[model samples]
Target: MPHRTYLTTPIYYASGAPHIGHAYTTILADALARFARQSGDDVLFLTGTDEHGPKIEEEAARRGVEPIELCDEMAARFRSAWERLDIGFDRFIRTTEDEHKAVVRAFVQRLHDRGHLYAGSYEGWYCVHEERYWTEKDLGPDNTCPDCGRPVRRIEEENWFFRMSTFQDALVAHIRDHPDWIVPEVRRNEVLGFLEKPLGDLSISRPRSRVQWGIPLPFDDDHVIYVWVDALVNYLTASGAVDPSLGPEAPGFEDPTGSWWPADLHIMGKDILTTHAVYWPTLLMGAGVPLPRHLLAHGWWVVGETKMSKSLGNVIDPLQLQEQYGTDAVRWYLLREMPTGSDASYTPERFLVRYEELANVLGNLAQRALSMIVRYRDGVVPEGDAGGLDDAVSTTLDAVAAALGDYRLHAALAAAMDLAREANGYVEAREPWAQAKDPARAGDLDDTLATLARVLGVLAALFHPVCPERSAELARRLGLSGVQTLQEARTDAPGGRTVERGDPLFPRVDV
Candidate 1:
């Protein structure tokens, strides 16, 4: 049965231009969305920029531009980058949008009405860079912000607070009940370890006098919503679960099944795991909303064992890489090189290795099979059985589905690569060139050529999720309109169509 699969990537903080880190999460979600669609599921893939925060205000002042002006520019850069990299997100949501503001206001108001919110005061160390409050214990040595290694300032302010602590027991119970709610096992245990201590109420508002570039609290005009509060509601806003025009007693307010709420999966880097797994879920509970089905905290892309950071000047701009090696190559390298949910290093040498795998194995197979069909059989695919390779294709298709079901994307690509290798080995064993030289071997040659053509067609479908463009080119060369689904590929096994040989799908790249 086809079902809706709602997936999301964290709305990137719009304080700087996007880098490889940003590309990884969006591309990962894009590949998953593509696979779901090919498998006949309804998918809503959401990604965008988080534009409200003190960080944005500070960055704008340094650049001598209004916060909104800076947001407009940065958001465009992110959108442009995703376009170049073929990120097919269904909705590019911006917190600055009026619709998003309406949803945020309504959500906070619901919390306030239910007594989940209260007036509070706080005096603590605040990290303007992270837009978060940090206790002394969380601060690093020399009193730096633990997350970013930046200086913190002492602030005493009146604010609105959500009754997050009130739900701590329930949250822990839910986590314990659903052990797989947070993925990668290690992250789940991390959140559980944090829960071993007390959970405090979340400070959900800041004074407008201190941070003016945010949504003003719906219940209090003197204060504005905390950036995380406004930012986290983006998932709810895009899910169509909150109707700003309706009151708290509305039917849809209680039952959000009609919309895409309770997202199937939320994808983000490990740095923001607490925001999604803890703060976001408790916030939803307070608003009488259901929590997302799953949370995935993937590791970072590092350089020399250090997380790539713009401050260190180690950030890799994906668009620049795309300019040299097409978008699919960049996508392939990121998805194939990184083990899903684990840190992977970024190096030119490793990238070329993956590229050559494409060039020498998958790309080589396409070149050989299609060119031979054009050369040996007058440009038409010969009709025959899949030449004893039927089991290989079936096994690969099952492996891809199983791996993707577990969100093990690297494993899925590995399965497909193995199939490509198997096809190459089959080519060596059959040796159609020798078969074509003898009159008595005509039947054997037809079966060999048919088998290669069939495998190439299947490979096109298997690789479509990770490398859509390259797969489409291969499908076109196989005389198909475009890449097909697993079902379509299994049944169509290239035969009786004119095949065209084109340039290699992935030409070898030199360092």
Candidate 2:
């Protein structure tokens, strides 16, 4: 059986429209999933919207419609944007689904029965935007939400409380023993710092009078589940582990069971470190489920040193950008410009710069090499000695695979780009243009075209995860249909096969 890799993107909030930040996270998850699949792993990728919350309810009331109506419209927008980007997620989970509600109730009831939950009355600083309670000490100097820096309201209510404090020490030790559990050395340390403070019991529900737009606690229908708790269970709920009905049918075998439990990776923005790193693990331990193997916290995108927001009138729409440039071009920009676990600046100028390299470097190489094959070798991929190109291509592939192994996306892209640059240099050195001058030098020309084809093959396979459509086109152009693996890349071009060239994969764009 292939190694199983289950991963998830932090579900986008349904209260807002999809933006470039959401697009970036989804694309990153998609690329990682694609890489795992091409590396011969059984991969399950999940992404979706968090549709229940007081915010969604308020927004609906203002619009004179049901909260579900608002959620449906916003969820459709996200689905459309992801489809436009060609995100091949295995499952797109929405919290409003009936199966999801069942899973939430069942999971929470288990926690209640396990003595991890109890009834309580509490007064605290609550951030509506974050759906979290902040202690007086947890608040910023301006008395705002520490996470989002938004104002908080003081609220007193009777609700169910989770015994998150009980497992604090265990979580800290687990993280220390397995430092890689939380990625990006910086984020790991931040979580440790947060743990230095005593852990507090979590308020785990909202009275119906206070907020009613969530799953009802299984034991008590008068209170709705806390938004964070409801949202966190989704990771397990969407898998076939906790609630079979909630999970979609896994493509291959029947009854997936817990094969995908203890997820391989949970990809989220750095802002949610406490939720995934602390609350999630403690909740899992309380319910007797193993912790996810890894938590990767990535950075945010800012527009010219300012965070993009609607009130600020500066949000970047992902669909508009994709429409302006091809989907792969936009995907390339996201992968190329940002290092994993680092903030990336989003600007039209920076986008065009990265976009140029795709059209000029990779695009130019493919067009020149294949056009030569057709002109000099009758469009047949010849198996002339790959020459030094084999070592060059192989080395780059190793570098790319290594970088991907560590989740260094920008580095992986750089490794692939280096191979493209070297191939271009090899073309210049061989002067394939001048080599074709002699009709008698046909064998020598075949050897040159052969090496170029092999190099292009490796590039297409290596880049397949990042830019699927263009990479697939290039793979077919090299006479290797669906050639998406490293092993397949090596054995491509069995010496004398015809291939076709399409219009330019990325037409050069004017900045």
Candidate 3:
């Protein structure tokens, strides 16, 4: 049976506009989803906007608009941006959606019924920006929210709380038993160390009198669910956990139980690991739902050595990049430059450098090889004699296949391109144009053309997920159908398909 993979980015908060960080995570998820599909896995990719919370309410009020109106407009902007970026998400969920509300309510009621929730009166320093109440020491030096750098107001209210403290040992033990569940040894250590301290009961509801922009609590009429609780349920809601009527039409619609239940991986930014890796699993455990198999926390994309912030005016609009550079270029740069679980900086100079190298060096080689075949072979794909070609071509294909099998996309792409580089050298050494004049060297020309076609076919397969449009174009030009898998390209090959010489694969851009 094939595997099932579900990947998601944190539902982005709508109080701020979409930025490069948003694009980075979503695009990474999209690439992973695409790769999984190519590798014969059923993939569910979810992305969306988080439309509730105090920050959103404040932004709406400041703009003299209702919260729903504000969310509608911001969510549209996010949708437009993702569409422009070609993020092939399985579903775009909104926290304000009716389906989502039902899921959140059900999730909360499950915990309540299990005795994991309690009605309580609480007093603490609340950060409107963070939409979270913080203990006195959790506040920063300026008496503000530590994460958001905003002033906190001391408030007292009646609310519902989750017994997060009750799960401390279980969470710790879970982490210890499944060390690989949390990615990058460093992040796992950080989560473990944080859990070593006394855990606090998490406030799960906010007084509706104070905030009315969230999902209403199941038992309490005066309070709405907190942002994290409202937001995190999106994962389940998108999977049809809340509404039995929806059936498999949910996000990972293909194999809801077999491969899709208990997600194979949950990708998130480091800031939310506590919520996703810690609170989320605990919530699942309390509700008797299966915990996700893995939680991979990646670092943030920092601007000028600090996290991107709207106040600093450093938040990058991803659409601008998509418009200036094509979608595939932007997508490739995000995945290629950032190592999983590491931070990557975005700069125009760096992007331009990479574009030039890929376009001029790797792309040009394939173009030249095909262009030569069209010029000399009358657009006929010459058949290869596996026993007759240079040994280097076979060696490169073996290495490329090995890299691809291991999920090393960047390395695999490089190895695949190296075949083109070798073919180019062979063309240079043989001087095919000069060799065409001698009838004695006819076999040499056929061998060279065949080798080039074989290498180009392999590249089309390897690059299909990363650059789908370009790969299809290349495949058509090489007289082959759009390939679905690397293995398909290698076996039962299209040996004598007609070749179409077209424009350059990666067009050069001036930065």
TM-score of every candidate relative to the true structure: 0.98, 0.94, 0.90
lDDT values for all models: 0.90, 0.85, 0.76
- Between candidates 1 and 2, the one scoring higher on TM-score is 1
Candidate 1, residues 1-511, lDDT tens digits: the string is 5799999999999997888888999999999999999989999999999999899999999999999999999999999999999989999999999988988888888899999999989999999988999998898988899988999999999999998998898899999999889988899999999999999999999999899999999889999999998999999889987777775554545688789988999999998999998899999889888889999889999986777887889888888889999999999999999999989999988888988999999999999988898889999988877545888988998998888877889999999999999999998998989998998998888889888887888889889888999999999988888888888877675669899998888987767
Please, what are the lDDT tens digits per residue for candidate 2 over residues 154-193? Answer: 9998989999999999999999999788988899999999
For residue 148, model 2's alpha carbon misses the true position, in angstroms, by: 4.4
Which candidate model has the greater TM-score, 2 or 3?
2
Error of 3 at 465 (Å): 2.0
Error of 1 at 255 (Å): 0.9
Clashing pairs in 3: none
The TM-score of candidate 3 is 0.90
The CA-based lDDT of model 3 is what? 0.76
lDDT of candidate 1 at residue 456, scale 0 to 100: 83
Best by lDDT: 1
Candidate 2 residue runs with Cα over 4 Å from true position: 137-151, 243-258
lDDT of 2: 0.85
